[model samples]
Target: MNDEPKSISIKDIAEALNISIGTVDRALHGRRGVSEKTKTRVLKTAEQMGYKPNLAAQALKLNRRISIGVVLPKHISYFFDPLRAGIRAAAGAAMGSQISLEFHEYPRIGSGDIEALEAAHARKYDGLIFLPGDIQRFSPLIRKISRSGTPMMCVGSDAPDTGRIGSVSAHAYISGSIAAELLAHKLPRKANVAILTGELSTLDHAEKLSGFAATLAIQAPHLTLMPTLEGHEKPKEAYRQALTLMRQKDRPEGLYLSTANSIAVIEALEELGLLGKVQVVATDLFQDLATLIKSNKILATLYQRPFTQGKVAFENLVAYLTRGNLESPVVQLAPHIVLRSNLPLFASRISETDEGEPESDSLE
Candidate 1:
């Protein structure tokens, strides 16, 4: 007979304001040690959201500290750093002092992901979050972890067949399709376009390559698709291969760097004096990439929103762990296209504040 709205709690208020629950509790109770500014904001938000505190539920939730393990790559700091920030930001806002995050970092994607993953699995934390370098290689272990009744959240990439709970990443296929369409319109004279990817073995990279090829064939038949180059996400290898590709007699007129490792490839283009000559669509954004986009050296970039991905992955994993929110197993966020005209909008967020190392947040 009664169908009414659920009462708002301190957690909801904390999440809305992106602050700790303890701070909200302190502010709402007129307790000492909370800033006046924060107290005023909390009161305003509580009144606006129609807060009805449940003291018993708040005390019960605060008694348990959830331990979470985060495993991600260390090589590509440009993308992974913001991702770490996002996770930390989410944990701080939602769980406050009731969460313990143990971040484990490996050398690169393919190099040490498995070892770190296995070690994290051994710990048997409340939930696990990681990026899968090779889906096949990670599937068995992920399946085992899943069988152990642990929830795992994959970020940046996915192991679909594995028994992991879910994933949060960019739309890899759409990212490639956007790049192909951009290049097709940029170069309409039956020119050659090449894709420089990290490793096709990875699902994300393979999907991007496939989408680019399929779209290029359908949208621009005049343009020839060159053999996809794999850099293994190594800076030196990418630079060397880029140099070799650019120096070829029949070099591509357009290039799609489908990984965040564009600086080295861009450097190679600069060395070969092909910055303006060749149209480039890079993946992800950084300060240098923004400058290049502004100068017309790079036509545009696909902003993958690594910070948002990390934040979403953490939030989703926590939700599933606490409330069994497993409605969507895979969460794919759309990519943003950044061009010369709109480079200023992302300039502030792309600025590097720290070294972007996940090891800094380690529990050990």
Candidate 2:
């Protein structure tokens, strides 16, 4: 083992520490092992070198097919459509992977524990792509899987310790920055902003708010966003909160929510007949919102490609499985602005592919 940490294998320790391979092997397995003092030395040396068990090698030895199970937040039209498309594109590109992928969707993200747990049973796969629940609770399980050599990836939001693990998602903080810009340009002066949020314990929620507030401090100095109203990740519930906010004497000019479930906000604004007045900005680009954009209702939106997210994850796993390329330990797609006038610019029109050219990704 080197002084600086290394991903040492048994052979490395045998050579570097000048111990016999048999001694090193016995030390590792504890099979009537070596002398306690020698075992301790070997173990200490291995730990100091950052030696980790190789799960991929074992899977290959066991002749396990490389498969990844993808967990998503329901097959709702908003995130699913594009994410599914990206999955297909990525899957096609991962020919060397020789792997299969499956998706498990959960409808009740904010509340349903039973259904979510049941969906975790991916009997045929080797790795996972998780759209996680509460990070404080779910992180340990994710970590445990990673320790066991499963290449776990997450999109949308993630838990703590995600840096050492795997991810293919957006810079949520940048998304918030974009939202701040959208709000800044729409409003003539700085005013109160209201954000509908879910459990703040989630990392994405925290980072996004941080990004929004920090950027607002610099860009829209007069803007004062109120304390978060728990939207419970339900659009209908968010709508109710929007109603209450609209009733306030000092109503906010900007309304931002970090969920695909912010459909409630629209309905709420519609109910108060103040949909036009409230500068609504959020994280989803659903078909109805697209329609509304055409009519000049939605000012702008922040888009993350969930499909590309899923596809990239699959491609990564397959590439690792087939080509042994492990350099890409993390993936970050860029964030883009989608305004009403240029909404069509982002259209992942299936027909666009027939023109013998790739579609434009604005963030690129």
TM-score each candidate.
Answer: 0.80, 0.77
Best by TM-score: 1
Residue 92 lDDT (model 2): 65
lDDT of 2 by residue, 1-364 (tens): 1122223567677777899977977887686858998899889888877766555544554666566676666534566556655766776665445556776767755566335534564353566666666777776666656554556666666654632245666777887787887788877685898777765666777777888888888998888878787776666666777788888999888877766566678887788887767887867576677776677777777776666666676666665554333455567667656777788876643121111113234231
- List the global CA lDDT of all models: 0.84, 0.66
Which stretch of 10 consecutive residues in model 1 shows the poorest summed lDDT? 355-364
Q: Candidate 1's residue-wise lDDT over 96-208, tens digit each? A: 77778999999998998899999998887878999988877888888788767677899998888676778988989988999999999999897899999998889999999
Stretches of candidate 1 off by over 4 Å are 1-62, 353-364
Clashing pairs in 1: none
